[model samples]
Target chain A: MALFTEAFLTALLAGAISAGIPLLLVGLGEQMSEKSGVLNIGIEGMMLAGAYTGFLIAWKTESMGLGFLAGAGGGMFVALFMAVLCVRLGLNQIVIGISLTLGAEGATAILHYFQFSRTYPRLPATLKWDIPFLHDIPVVGPALFGREPIVYFALFLVSVFAYLYRRTHFGLALQAAGDKPAALDSSGVDVLKVRAVAVLTTGALAGLGGAFMAIVGAGIFVPFMTHGNGFIGIVLAMLARGRPLWVLGGATLFGACLSLTTALQVAGIDIPTDVIQMLPFAAVMVVLIVLGSKANLPVSLGTAYARGER
Target chain B: MTSEMAIAPDSGENERKSRLNMRDDRLHFLIITIGPVLATLVIASFILMAMGVSPLDYYGYIFQRGMLSPSGVQATLTRMGPLLLIAASLIVCFRAGIWNLGGDAQFILGAVFVAAAGPELVAILPVWLMLLLCLSIGAAAGAVWSLVPAFLRAYQGINEIITTMMMTFLGGSLANVLVKLVFLDPETTVPQTRTLAVSDRLPRLFDTTVSSGVLLGLAAVLIVHFTMNRTAFGLRLRIVGANAKAAVHAGLPVATLTVIVFSLSAGLAGLAGAVAVLGQTGNVRADWNPAYTLTIVPLVFLARFNGFATIAFVFLFSVLSIGSESAARRLGVPNYFTLVTMATLLILMAVAEMIDQRRRKRKEV
Candidate 1:
């Protein structure tokens, strides 16, 4: 009759990881874009596009890998506009980003209406890859080590991003573009090119994250299923302050809180569901505000770079 | 001696060229402003074609239903109340160079505050007085909700966009909680606040179905426009917005202006919410978001911060929104098609602005 039974604890842990993976992917991607001086407000749109395409592809081909690829492609497709308009053409990033998200939402919803409205097909449970020794460990073992390959891949991306930021020339270039575009331009590096590449990569990673949400996290795609995850990712990236590890930590905390909400609901807690559901958002914002206040964003963030113009 | 003689003729030629440039500037401005709208319509037509709907027919139906019909016009007029207020809110923040994306949150909170307080106040006071109290409470709530982001941006240099949006998500959840648990009407099976009697609601305008809230919306827009353009306070806010560091050096109250802008913007959004409830809906429902904030954003931007222009655009937008529902159902298309069109218009506008900037830079070179 205990509320904290072993089975319940394990489910909560598993749910946390499932929720955390998409956020991690999005945070990492957003961090890269921010590093290169692009805020990427349209990432939500990219995520939605990825979710739709990823789900559609997975549903049709019955292959998760192909679905993830298609999702990334769809995200990049939306990002192409971001690169051209915000980065190349020097448009206002916020306005363009908002429009892109709205456009993507409408486009995907219409696509869904035509293709899947009647059937509303859902994907099967994703295949998990169990790590040999890790899978046998108590409560945490099955939850962390027995997730789908995408979960591990998402975890691995944290390390990959950390390495790229700390030890790579490309990372240095990205940092320079965000901090001092004029200096970077003077040094013969193409600021526009750097920003364009960063934005596109952000799109790809965000798309992959969206795909993971559709295929592994939810086992289905719904219109606007990304549901502000992209915005949460922005907050994570900002709070992380260029630290990939912090992004991982923040994402994990957020995901765990989400799982806790679900647990509370399932346990028949006598509270309004809306209040219970608000825990994750409130928790994340409070934590970030308290802990990440000193974190510094890029100086040149959200400003268009015009050569020789102050 | 020869160089001096040459300079005199070149100076005269430059004078003529400058006058020509002045004449061309007006034409360039017109192209930059209007070209994007035409482009968006053309692109949206392609999307309509892809959806197997006739663009002309859809647009025709929208015009017929939204503007030509009496009921549709009334509906459109009623819808404009929230949009115009939100547009006024946006004008304040954007003119101050502050991005207060929390209008949606402020709006929902405002509505919730009115829903919870209006019925109780109605019992104690006359209907008009009760309505005034509800509106003030809603505006106060919205302003309170916005204070955190405003303070953060003004003092800590935090970006308001992320903070405001986060607040929006939280506000939405809180609104639902208020509707379902805190202020649920026992009489109704549905999770909604206690509805006000029809007699207690805002009086209809000219005996038409349209609510008098439209007049309030127009008044708010006019006041905002005047505050942003004609007054010395407006000039000071503009100076602060133009360059905060410069304003500080000039001893202008940059921080105070920032907070004031946010309060005014959020207060207007709250007023919009109050108007929607008292003038039309009469109550709040769980998980219901009019989403008036996002819908009005493009209209505000398209108007270029001009109050009269905003009224025209809001009129057009409300017509599209109200008229498109029937057309969407008939064509088997989603009502979101209008969103697609509006979003496209916004993008095209950004692109046009970019192009205009590029051309101007090229001319300077």
Candidate 2:
């Protein structure tokens, strides 16, 4: 009859990690894209593509690894459109980004309707890897350490990205590509190439996030399953500026808010569940408004890099 | 909030532009405009073939039921009421270089508000007066929902795409709350807003089944076209769209224009919702989000944000949607194919624009 049992709190924290990992991956990818000056709004579509293909492949092969690969590949496939249209052809980034998402939604829905709508098959439970000594620390350990390998890898990626942005030459080129493509071009780097690679990498990460959502988080793929996670990732990336650690912080905060929503509902809160569900989105909006004005942004963000064009 | 869309691939040059001032040659313009639609049909036919549905049969059925039949024509016209208004809304936003993808949320908010209020007002006021008030309420609700995102984007330099989308998620959830709890009609068997009688709805056109809301939608798009293309205000907005920095340097109120763009576009979208509730749906049901906005996004883009062209595309889309539903029923294929086709058309539209731009540059060379 206790409202906040130890087990309940552990499950809540575990759910936070389950949700945060996808946002973390997506935000990391989106950060790289923004750093390279492409807004990359199509991450939503990429995530959906990954979720569908990831679920389909995992179901067919019964291999989680291959499923994640297919998910990433599917995202890259959608990103190809962004690369060609927005980057290569110099089109509107926002319009193309939105169109790609719409396209992915329709395509995935059709594929799902034809392939899996009848059986509604779901995967088995996600396997967890218990870290020695760490996972025994009661609720915190089980929630943070005794989880899927991808969760650890996603966390590791935060540090990797931190090092990538602050130390590497490629990171400087990326910064140059976003801040001043002309300077990067004068220095003999192809600005378009840098931006293109960044976008494609974004697709892979977003796709993997989608795959994780399906194979590990939900164990099933429905059309539009990614929901607004991709958009949320964009928010995270924008807020992070160029800091992967900040992205992690923002994403975790969002994930914790999601858990809080579930907890409030479970506690028999009088408000409608629909109203309760608005917390994460409302939280993200408030965060964006409060921190957005002061966040440093890429000068060339959302613009196509056309040589010799001011 | 960002100046990244400067001329949308216009090579960073600030130039005066409008429907009247577009300098494309007729052949180039025709190819760019018509190419994507035909290509989309061809690709969609291939998809149909893969599904074992004969393309000929599908096309034949769509044409017969959606266009050649009386009842279908009436239905298509009724569908156009909301779509045409949305097209107008999109034209306004795109013209100002602001993206308002929150149409779905705005539309839902507008429709739910009107549905919740209409019955009470119709009891006290004349039908015509009630309808006007309901539509106004819908528009005001939509504009109000848009204010936060508009303010954030205009004053704070945050992207509206993120803010608008976040608001959309909120709007959907909030509308469900309003409909399921606050607006539930106790007299109804199901949890839904109270419905008005058919006679209380927008009157049909001259004994036909088509609602008079179609005229409102059509007139709105036309007015947008004339105003955006012909008026000094339209020119100022276009100047902001083409180059916000230039507009600012020219002493235009850039932030105000951006907010006005949001209010006008979202207001029209809300009006579309009002028209639908007033003319077609009659009531807001629990968990009903028709998602007509995303479909209209591609349509406006394929129309290149032009008003007259948008009118033509809306009619075609209405027919396609009506026909596709029946075709999907008969062919045992899912009806989502219409969305796939629209999405393909959108991609092709971008490709076509790219080709047109390349050809223009080559000609100049």
Best by lDDT: 2
Predicted candidate 2 versus true structure: per-residue lDDT over A99-172, tens digit per residue: 88888988898899887665679998877899999989988999998998889989999999899889999999
The residue-by-residue lDDT of candidate 1 on B47-67, one tens digit each, is 989988898988888889999
Interface RMSD for each of the candidates: 9.4, 2.4
Question: Which candidate leads the pack in TM-score?
Answer: 2
How far is B171's C-alpha from truth in model 2 (Å)? Answer: 1.2
After superposing candidate 2 on the true structure, give the runs of residues whose Cα lies further than 4 Å from its correct spot. A264-271, A288-295, B6-24
lDDT of 2 by residue, B196-304 (tens): 7888888899989999999999999999998987899998888888878899999999999899999999999999989899999899998899888877876787677
Candidate 2 residue-wise lDDT at B108: 94
TM-score (C-alpha, index-matched) for candidate 1:
0.93
Instruction: Score every model by TM-score.
Output: 0.93, 0.94
Candidate 1 docking classification: acceptable
